[model samples]
Target: MKQVLHFINGKFLESTSGKFYDNYNPATGKVISKIALGSEEDVDKAVEAASEAMNGEWGNIKINDRIALLYALADEIDSRFDEFLEAETLDTGKPYTIARHIDIPRGAANFKVFADTMKSVADEAYQMDTPDGGIAMNYSRRYPKGVITVITPWNLPFLLMTWKVGPALACGNTVVVKAAESTPTTTALLGEVMNKVGIPKGVFNVVHGFGKDIGDRLTSHPKVDAVTFTGSTPTGKRIMQSSALDLKHLSLELGGKNPAIIFADCDMKKAINETVRSVFANSGQVCLGTERVYVERPIFDKFVNKLKKAGENIKLGIQHDESSDMGPLISKDHQEKVLSYYKLAKDLGANVVLGGGSPKMENGLENGYWIDPTIWTGLSEDSAIVKEEIFGPCCHIAPFDTEEEAIKLANDTEYGLAATVFSENLSKAHRVAGQIDAGIVWVNSWFLRDLRTPFGGMKKSGIGREGGHHSLEFYTELKNICIKM
Candidate 1:
């Protein structure tokens, strides 16, 4: 089994606490590795290292050199793409296909995009003529917020970490990343890539372990300048409170119960495929997955039937099984958490139109934390199953009589992370999308993302954005300079 250690100051270090957490493979419920569980003391050491780098060569490196480092890192990731794909699948229990096609490639893309963006970063300036015929000038310069704490979630572990790290490093800020305890292998691999690319020591660090053990200390440390986290809403709240103690800059991408609204005038076949892809692609573990699907009453019955068929066809297999469409949840505990929602839906009289239980597999795979893709109907908008984030391969379907009702249903949940509107009518699609409260809205499609666009959530889903210019802004602090001539 692999033994994972903390990555501090460009070296793998043993935990000072001499404590470790067993990392499991959700596919087989087997212990694959033991990750070093860090403590407050470890966090202090990391912060101290990062502080030194921030005040030294890394903080004062030429912008061209920083951009070149980012480019080199991206190239390294691309060259080792297959290795990353395998490790990501092993660590997260996602299908090998997804890791290859989506996660790993996007992670590399993040670095490339940010590196290119750095060359175009320019300061803003304004000049005014004074009454004495002299020129007065005001200019704004962006500087890195040193020593940022990047805490990423288990789902899309490497991809999400790169989403923050790419921008943070490009902006010249040093980072101490806390990879999720459930999946740390890919992140450990990233540490290796960082070293290979010759990123300065302490400029990038990775600490493995649970959030409770070290997350609080990382966010609350006096020297930490900012915290960028992607995880549960409850944890986001905690980070918010703790970071507020020192008034640290915070960028959080939290939980969501996203909705998919299917209009009757839509292309039925595409809608069915995209809707299923939305919820079952990552076994519905995505924060932007459409957990609550609202269909126009005219086509509701047909849509639900199609969704049920798609769910039934989803193949649940082990991570390396290329034939599989989906894989297990991250852990047995998460599997149970998702299963409880099925019971709740049943108790609320929601019709289990499709799968509502775990699947029994052959070839020694029965012990995995696997759940069959499930579909439900006959549930009210306010039902617990509809309003809450199941974060599994399950979805609740309901019919809406009018456009206004569809809009209302889409915006009903506390989360406003992402929503999808599928309709053949362009006017209606635009109309409904505009009215939706989500930060990202898809029209006639799902998961079509542009790296240059702003990505974030609204309401309780999250605070701040993390993509393109928004990311650059979040990782930096602005200083204004004024001169009279």
Candidate 2:
């Protein structure tokens, strides 16, 4: 079996403890690899290496040289595109086409985008007259914020991991990443990319294991200067509490029970197409995926019918099959969790308009973590299915009488990560987008992202923004200098 080992100090190392976690192929329900379960000892080693690099060769590297390395790293990742695509597809069970087109390219782009962004940044400078009528010059410069601990989720593993790593490295901070337990292959593979591109030893590191085992050790470690995590809200809260002792810098992009509001005047074809993608893309594992949909009452029946038909038509086949529209959940445990919610929705009297159970698979795929794309209606706002983040290929639809009601329904949850407004009326779209309490409100589209814009959640969805210059803010510390002239 493939052994997923730690990448520390530019080398792959087994855990000090000989313990291993079985890495499964979600599509086949087979043990594909063994992941080293990192312990506190491993954490300490990674941290020490990261700290040493920050205080040694990497810290003193010139900004121009560092940016060039980042660009080169992006190039190297592109060069090894097929290798990355395979590892990501093997780990994530996402479609090969999805990984080829979206994940791998975006992963490479993260490095390039951040490198270009870091190159273009201009610091602040000011001239002031002193009380004694002398002139003073005040200027600011940014420095790396020491070592960062990056904890990534399994969904979109490669893309999200690089999303943080790109900026962290671009800002010249060393990072110790804790890859999600079920998906460690791509992370292990990244160590090769870093070394091949000539990134300094200890500048990039990866540790594999369950969050409970090594999460606190990494997050609460005295040497770690910051924690950037992408996961659920409760986990984010625990990380916040743990990091509070040191008051470490935190950038958390947590869970979302995101919503989609469809107006009667929306382009029906466009809205249905986009909403289906929003709800079922990546098996609905996207943090921004919509779990609650509100359609204007006049068109509710037609919308539900079309959506049901679309859900029915989604192809759930083997991961390698290019024709497959969807793939399995990340693991059996996650599959069970999503299944429980499906049962609860029915028990709570939800109208199950579509699938609510697993689809049958044959030819060595019988035990795979398969779940049918599901749809529901006639559930109250207080229903668990309506209130919580399922993080699966399912959504509950409801009819709204007015624009005010639609907005209210969209904002009803505690999550403020993302929401979508589908309307032909530009004025109404703008008006509703403004009132929705999400960090990102998409009007007439879904999953369209610009790397230059700020990305994070509001309220409980996330703590800080990251993207473009906002990422620079988190990855570096600013120091101001003043001189009298």
Candidate 3:
């Protein structure tokens, strides 16, 4: 098996603790690699390297130089696109088509867009006239926060890491990234690209391990100036509490139990297709997956039937197979968790309109963690299945008679990450979108993202916005300077 080690100071190093953990291929249910289980000592070394790079050569490099480096990294990533596609598929159990079409391309786009966008950032200035005839001027300058800890989850490991890392590095911050142990392959490959592109030593570091072992140390370390994490709400809360000791800056993009409201006047075919995509894409492991769907009463039955047909047609096979529409969940534990929800929903009297159990597979995939796409109806609004984030290929749908009730049902959950409204009535689309309490709302589309837009959640979904200027701002601090003349 291949051994994956930490990347510190532009070099790969084994953990000081001399311990390792297994990394499994989700599709085959077999260990493919061994990753170093980093300890607090490993985190300290990475942080120290990051701090030195931030204060030394990297800090002194011109903005144009930084932009050049970013473009070079992007080019390197594009050159190795096929390798990244395979690594992401093997690690995350996503279909090869999805990885090739979405994940890898988007990772490269993040770097390219952020490199171009950072060129447009300008400081603010103001002129004030003094009462005593003296002129005064105030101006703001943005500066890096020095040594940030970027912790990314497994589902979209490379994509989310670049989403945070691109802006942070573009803004001149050094980063110590802790990739989730389950999906560290592509991220390790990223370290190689960074080194080959000649990004200054210690400017980027990757440490792989379980969260409890090294994550707590990295987040709470004194040398680390800030943290950007994408994970579960519970984990985000713990990181928030731990980082509060030093009052380190934090940007968290956490969990969601999102909703999709389908109106009677919608394009039924479009609504059904997008709704199915929202729920079953990436096996419904997305944080923005629309777990609770509310359909307008007049078309509710028809919509359910269409959605059931769509779910039944989704092809589940090995990740590398070109014929597969969707692949397995990340691991056996996660598959069991998702399957438990299906049982609970059935026991609570929710009608399983489509799949409600795992499907058996032949060949070597018999032991793989696979769950059939499932759709449930006849469930109450407040049921556990409706209210919780299943994070799987399952959704519970119900009917609403009025636009007001649709909005009510959509915003009923504590999560406010993302929501969608399908309506041909432009007025209703805007009006309902305004009423929903989600950070991101799609009037007639799903997952259509622009890199320049503000992205994050409200309520328990997240703590701060990311992408575009928001991300740049998060990685830097503003200082106001005043002069008298």
lDDT winner among the candidates? Answer: 2
Question: Worst ten-residue run, lDDT, model 2?
Answer: 89-98
Model 3 RMSD, rounded to 1 decimal? 0.8
Scored by lDDT, model 1 comes in at 0.89
Candidate 3 — worst ten consecutive residues by lDDT sum? Answer: 114-123
Question: Count of backbone clashes for each model?
Answer: 0, 0, 0
- Model 3 alpha-carbon drift over 4 Å, by segment: none
Pairs with steric clashes in candidate 2: none
What does candidate 3's lDDT look like per residue over 115-147, in tens digits? 887889778999999989989999998888889
How do the residues 239-357 of candidate 1 rate in per-residue lDDT, one tens digit apiece?
A: 99999989998898999999999988899999999999998989889988889898888888899888888888888888788998899999999999999998898989989998898
C-alpha RMSD between model 1 and the true structure: 1.0
What's the residue-level lDDT of 181 in candidate 1?
Answer: 90
lDDT of 1 at 159: 92
TM-score of every prediction relative to native: 0.98, 0.99, 0.99
